[model samples]
Target chain A: MQTHSYTSRRELETYHFHPMVAALVPLAFLLLQAFLPKIFPRLLILDLPLVAVIFFAVARRSPIAGTITGTVIGLLQDALTHQPIGVNGIAKAIIGYAASSIGVQVDVENLTTRILMNFVLSWVQSLLLFLIFRYLLGLRDTHLVWLHELVRASLNTAVAIPVFLLLDRVKLRE
Target chain B: MESFFSRFKNQLVLIVILLVQTIALAVQVRRPVEPGHPDAESVRLLRYWASSLMTPAERISTGFGHSVRGGWSSYVGLRNVRAENEALKKQIAEMRLQQAAISEDALEGQRLQKLLDFREHYVASTIAAQVIGTSGSEQSRMLTLNKGYEDGLKTDMAVITPDGIVGKLRLVFPHSSELLLVNDPTSGAGVILESTRIRAILHGSANGRVQITNLTQDSRIKPGEKVITSGGDQVFPRGLAVGVIESIVPDPEHQPYTLITLKPAANLFQLEEVLVITGTQPNLPGDAQQQLAADAEKHAADVSAERLPSIHDGPATEADPSKPTDETAPPANNSTDLVPKPKPALHPDRYSPGTAAPAAELTPGSPRPATDAPAVEPVRKTPVAPETPKEP
Candidate 1:
């Protein structure tokens, strides 16, 4: 059996990524999110952008960086959609910040922690989107089906596992 | 101030980001890009830049995927080619017989329409475009087309497949356009039931279902009834197949209104190529000259048939002057009261050569020529008439 060490906040290590990796990884995810479902519509259940945001935010462990990453990626995702811009931006920015803050407090390097973080944060991201769309934007048609959202978050979590592992190879120990 | 900023830098950044996005959202919500006034410049520019940045990669990926799939399907997937081809040939033969029958009906319809001076809008021109990507959000339900403003696409242009209507162009950038699918929550179309002719507004639900709204429970709508565009909204042409009703249930939110769900006529999820309606022209009398001549010949034969003693004797007994005589009466098979009339010379000002007649002049109950024979001289030949099959 493998053993892991619990690190304190001060001793927790933050990771850096190559500038090309940082930029291109999210772009690739966005492209996949936009185009892949055209071939296999069932792939729509996978939130690739959300997985990317969570992975990068948790890896960096910097709230400001996570917030900015979330904002940029969320706005880009919004631009591809017909809906009013910033709905995804707001949801993701908050999620990014929260994910990073959690990253700082906990040893996110652990497998179980990463899985739980992704699942919970994925659900929270959906909830934030629902609240923002319903309350702030007054999009009365936006209704959240709990079961559908649960499936989405679960699929996102499943995708995040392999995506985070692949991305971790690109992370530079800072 | 510097120390305070340093103490709450992350929180401040988050708040500022959220605030800016909220303000932008408010601006968009306040000044939506309504039809004919798509002047939300900043948002449009942002979307344009984003699409431009992403379009090349999407196009390359889409093209590569298509090439790979085509190669595999063309070369390796030949399991039942002979059987499928034979079946298709049989279907074509059956359809040819049906086409002959339909052609006669169409000619009769044209004669009646000319008699009443009825005009209708038809798809005049279309641009074929490839579906490259999607909005990637279930809530938005938009498609990204490879063609754009440079391809002569504009907002609100109807996008359709041979099977049925797909959507309308929502945003046109330089090299790409966004198509708001009919199943998007924000999308709506004017539709009518085929059998009952009950008109209603079609709406898209949040769960990506197309539905008809604003009908009471007492409405005689049934599942499997076909729905078609009414052309009242001016987006889609009249009689274009929209979808068929899948199910009907009472609306829980809106009292007394039934929620009628529709199964889209087009395979919206599997769309690869679609035709954008670039232009439409009103169906005019001179547009169907070939049909008119054929109908005129048929009417002459019918008159000759009616003059026979056995066939003419039955209606001659009750022949009132107000009713049509044997010479003017339609064929025995046709039940329409409209008599084929000789077409009058089109007004030079209203239907000049190389010009289209005004649609308003052909409204129902409009003044029509008094002649009852279906013979008319061709005024002008349209190079690309609506009846002509276009190669996409």
Candidate 2:
């Protein structure tokens, strides 16, 4: 496997998590994303599955693995919804790939970097969905409330701060 | 070619995967399965897999929660049981008397229905299901129920609570299904004002609030007027409680249409268990007499919210039909709660001797009739009750 050498700022070591953690984390996120809203509907603003996709993608630093993870998780999220599948899958795939590719060069370990990445990626994902629903699908009512999106992004990023830290503890080091 | 593939393998894989998914989406959109029909095979399989993975965990957790609450209520608490039991007995006695009159009115209404050859659908059966999860996005307002294909749940089946209609079942898996809530922007319902009878199209806004549109400026609706399903959408049975009108404003974009906001009857966010209406059968003249007896028996059997008389189906005449009990009485003030108040009996003069006039014509600020008004009006007016046929 050929990995891109984007930078030499620091020695980069590959970390491989236990395969079960890799599988279970995403599954748990998907389940909670689907389940928590039933108990506290306001929690919908936090997209945990998207957060997990970003965390795993950055931690693994493998664009291929990240893209695949995004695809599966996104599809699973779509399956839980009534919308036509793949809208989320495509958006998450791009986010996963971008985060991982960025991971390869930039250091995502800094809390500031992690927060900024999640905030930017959340907007990107929302914009992608808004565009798909509006132009591609010709859905008339699909309009993005910029303020709501901004607030949601902030909330997701805030959640990602702690979530990424917790998830990091579960990762197996090289 | 090998060198090129190796250099951009990750990008190439991501593009390929996205393209495949896009194609699938295109296929689904192009051949959009009609609502209420089974989804496309692949989507159905995907849903089955997703539900199979998640619903078990949800069921276990929900069951555990229920057990704890039930245990607390049963063994750990009984202080108010005596007071509650005595109050319920009194309520039941009062309902028995009202039940007798409602039964009579139901029979007369059925005879009128048969006379007019009125073919209408009523909820024939329902399966109780626990709400286990949701779509987790306010944009996609959906609930996941624990009952599914194995439980005879089907797409487009009306889901409800004792308070009002919730939504329709959008998809069914083996052990779980998705409820497309009425608050979803994509959802639309035909609804009418309880007293005004002004029909309009109700659609969910982006923020999960329901509003009525497609109303002509000539339509007269008030803020506190109760909204009920008009049954024109063919999804919900006519006369089911929907919501209370919150406000009405002219739609600036659509010249002739007014925008009326509503507060839904059931607490959507607080849902735990709901009924999935499985089937509906039309009322026929042959079954009308038999249905009358069955209606009485059904009303007798279940003395809970299911049997409560609809406030929308006010007595045909303004004469107090029965003693106003807390359960049956409309609130003293409509603005007291967010839940739609039970409608009081319409003024006797609203429907004139021969022709019915629009309820908006009633004199504004005219004092409402006292609850203890005479209860002996002849059963001349056709009752608006739909709850009788819903039993089963």
Candidate 3:
């Protein structure tokens, strides 16, 4: 297998999704994120919305598109929760921008690269959430249990493997 | 300038988006949209739009799953129906005898309440709702119910299961309402220990555990004591089961208070159907029941004095009433020297007939009652003896 290094903007490959696929895929993931935990609570560790955000951001490889997608998805996720409607928005926005920028430079199609990117980005998202809640929101009671968060990041990474593969079938290379 | 903007448009867009969301978050934190408060239109609209977009799919999915599970269980999972039926029948026979004894006790309680001219609220009506979805994050333990404002669900309405109190309605939409579960870090309720009658505030922790707060370290709280709603918060009805105390340890953060862990009475995680209390009626026995009271008193007199304690006998007063008595006071443990005093009972005048005060008149600690209906009146207004002082 050969890995392509997209050092220039012209060499970078981008993917576009159909309008319906773009709208429904994240919506389905959001529904599953909110609905499935009712049956299997351990699934709470799997951040389906975050996985979807990362997938779209990396696949599209456009910082602007990724930013907007992340903002919309994160805000929707926040709206579902009782917390203030922008905590996840800020975290996912940054992650989206970063993931897409990374995608533009590196071979994100490689399985090992995708897994490592997801694992590291999950931690980044978790840290952003912690800072937003603690310092920005002034919620002193907000704390992070390292072990729980580690398991969460790992779970999201593991689930992202299958999710990325499935989402790959829907994208149209541009 | 245009060329400069084009040179780094993505960075500029990201900055603008982050700044906007940060500002929105700051505004929300500054003025949180509490239930029933209509000040924050933008935040409310954002949430409403999100709910509108998501709830239809959730309802359909939940309904389908329930239908499939119900069909399977009803048709295929009936291996021991005969043995279960016989066991239930035997249990019913035993419960009948127990019910008779409890009825007598209830009658006696009614008589005493009448003698004291005490009035209390009873659940008058409830709306059954199905849980459709959750917040999906551990930090916010909110459940979405199928019933909404259109179904007469107002914010702060107490939601309960058959087992115990679940939570209260936090946000109500046109088609669905959000339930702030008892274990959310921001949630709290007034609870009392059954054995000790010690009232304390139940708080949910970030770790999804329920714990009793505002309790002094010296309070003699032990494991396994049942916790019940104290009706002090005015959201939950009095006497509803809340939880059981699981453990008590000294609070490392607050020096004077002990961290008492609680095991919730309801299996909150596994709830499917819940009842939202819509209305409450006042229970007041009247003078026409004087004959009934006399009969109850005579029945009480027939029972051996040793078996039943007289209602007239209040706590044993010490020579110096201010000093803590060994039997009546909470024991001072090795952790602390100060014993927390019991909270005073709510003044009867607050709920007296015809007052019909607005929600603002309620104490700050109590959640405002949802409706503005007139204060309930007794069958007949008759003066009676003072209320029996409760045990400390």
Candidate with top lDDT is 1
lDDT of 3 by residue, B1-392 (tens): 99989999999999999999999888888894555663377777887888888899989999999999999887765877888899999999999767656657768787688899977677878999999998888878988899899999998999999889999998899889999999998888998899889889998998888998788875567898899998899999888999888999988888778999999999988879999999876762344246456655665665634332332333432145686556545433322534555444355443444445555577877744644333343444567754543422
lDDT of 3 at B123: 80
Which scores higher on DockQ, 2 or 3? 3
1 or 3, greater by lDDT: 1
lDDT of 2 by residue, A1-174 (tens): 865466433235456789899889889998889888877888988899999999989888889989998998999998888788888899999999998988887879998899899999999999998987887677876789999999999999999999998988887765
Question: Could you tell me which residue pairs clash in candidate 2?
Answer: none
Candidate 3 lDDT (Cα, 0 to 1): 0.84
Best-fitting candidate, measured by DockQ? 1
Interface RMSD of 1: 0.9
Winner on lDDT between 1 and 2 is 1
* Tens-place lDDT digits, model 2, residues B324-386: 556655443324562555545464332323234346765778854433333334444567543
Clashes of 2: 0
TM-score of chain B of 1: 0.73
The parts of candidate 1 lying over 4 Å away from their true place are A1-12, B36-39, B76-82, B115-117, B284-392
The TM-score obtained for chain B by all candidates, in the order given, is 0.73, 0.68, 0.71
lDDT of 1 at A61: 88
Better candidate by TM-score, 2 or 3: 3
Sort by DockQ, top down from the best: 1, 3, 2
Model 1 / residue A106 / CA error / Å: 0.2
Cα lDDT tens digits, model 3, A1-174, are 765556554254688999999999999999999999888877777788899889999888889999999999999999898888899999999999999999898788899999999999998888898899899999888888888888988999999998899889998987
Q: Each candidate: how many clashes?
A: 5, 0, 0
